[model samples]
Target: MALSTAPGPPPPGLSAAKIVAYLHGPEPYLLIPDPTPGTHQALVRWLQGRQAVAGPVVARTDAGASLRWARTLLALTPQWPGTAGELLFVEDHLAKVVLFQDPLLAGHLSAKWLGRLSDMTPRQRERMEQTLLAWLEGGGAAEAAQLLRIHPQTVRYRLRKLERIFGGSLRTPQARFEILLALKIHGMAAECARLRHRAEELPARAASEPRRDARSIGR
Candidate 1:
């Protein structure tokens, strides 16, 4: 796979038959031999048709590395701002990918920054954590309020509470960085947990659903 900046259909000279496309499990993959800008254009069109989101197309020199890179991008999809079906590229989120590449490291950081806050009730902790992240990312109470869809006064209230819990550490650059990263990691972790629960229920869901015969469906 090769990365191309162009977006649209394949050039007239590029034959669709040359691109080998197939579905592996729930993902659709394409193998374009001697992939060029035109090939990538075609791929963009194909993905758009299916309303799919994908990772950056990596070099084929190491198939294993390519697969791993793709999986990493997919795992971090929850952190991205795009809605379902938008074509998002890994290039846009390289920093986050590196920051969260190691779950053990991310978990450690999350614990370090959030351990005290976790002692609070689940709902309160959630609100505080979200407020902290919004404040850090937005840089002010008004901006944070817009992000959280809450009143500016409410944001100030949470910030005051967070300041008491976190103390002057929130004033420091390094602590703020760690807190932001930890909060983001926590969000992604929650998404992963939900996906796991859904996967575990997949078999039961399939069994519970009625199946139709191929012939009967066509009749």
Candidate 2:
């Protein structure tokens, strides 16, 4: 089937019509096109090989299917220095899949969620962060209240505020799972940054140390 190279809508053609119809369906179907002669074919073969090992087999076709497949893949993958929409799309998708594949990956996804939470008011963010830390360190409401130096009822109030901020639906098991995941991610990133700063200071610290052994050797 002939493909359209037009900037606007796809030209009236069987391939374009078929693709439009396929996209409207629920079951995921990737439309990959045959590679052009020479360089393109080699690249296509390489991509095909890579995809073979990643997960499920995506189908190939000649009607702009490969472009759609690539767009979808890129959309699902993380992007830096780009639109928030792209980042959010990738974060959401990764949260769904990465948790199943790698525990560490879940932490990274959670960090992205925390990044979103950072946009909230400072008071709200502080309350939630304190609550989360207390919950993690202490486990139960009583312990959390002790850590925060607040009464149990006050702790409950703060938690309820957090629940409202996070939304009532998120108070459930699955939602809490995501919230915990995000908190871990944020904590890991903070720890990593702290470690990195300490490492950077080491060289300066080493340089500033007195050369006692050198002076003794010279004498």
Candidate 3:
């Protein structure tokens, strides 16, 4: 069953079975059986209201693993570097979760596919990566142009450049899949860097803010 760990009384249409008492604290979990679309939406809304996140459905015996998955999802939230949300669902990001389970492997895969692009300027690299990923996802310049909101000719130009860099690698199915996964990992890494920068700035930002004196509160 899926689990939500928002601290509060359970919502309507939920039963006693939905509530799981935690061994350590006042916080409780809601167990969702058979997460239909309606139920998913309901859980999403409930969690959103509480600014919480939920883990994927697993057998009751796998509750510990489910909580581990939830913590992983949490680590990717807000300042955690990847997706930020009031209520993130594991089902929506299963592929990413699976892909990131081994970050060292993911890093190596990204380096294998994207290492050459590092020589280019950031702007040049961004454009090429976006165009290439879109092309890979859409299977053609026209479809990729639509996805990127660029002209087909522009996509064609980028693809030609990419062809020179990637050569016959893009023509094979396995290589294409690997390149696509690598590009996604690269993007996630970029997001992580940005989030880390922002997080580092937080302490300095807080220290710079003026503190109010306790005696001034009643003024």
Find the candidate with the highest lDDT and give its number: 3
Better of 2 and 3 by TM-score: 3
Write the residue-wise lDDT of candidate 3 on 29-102 in tens digits.
55556566766666565555343546777788986777666655555554422223366677787776677767
Ten consecutive residues with minimal summed lDDT in candidate 2? Answer: 1-10
TM-score computed on alpha carbons, candidate 2: 0.42
Off by over 4 Å in 2: 1-108, 120-127, 136-140, 147-149, 210-219
lDDT of 2: 0.49
Residue-level lDDT tens digits of model 2 in 45-130:
32231221112223543334434333343423332221122111222334334433444666566665565566778888767787
Candidate 1's displacement at residue 42, Å, is 8.5
Model 1: per-residue lDDT, tens digit, 1-219?
Answer: 222122344445445547544554454444556557766576556555233334455566755455445556665443212222345555676766676778789899999989988679999998998899999999999999999999999999999999998999999999999898888888877877786576567777778999998878967
Which of the two, 1 or 3, has more lDDT? 3
Ranking by TM-score: 3, 1, 2
Question: What TM-score does prediction 1 earn?
Answer: 0.63
Candidate achieving higher lDDT, 2 or 3? 3
Query: Deviation in angstroms for 211 in model 1?
Result: 4.3
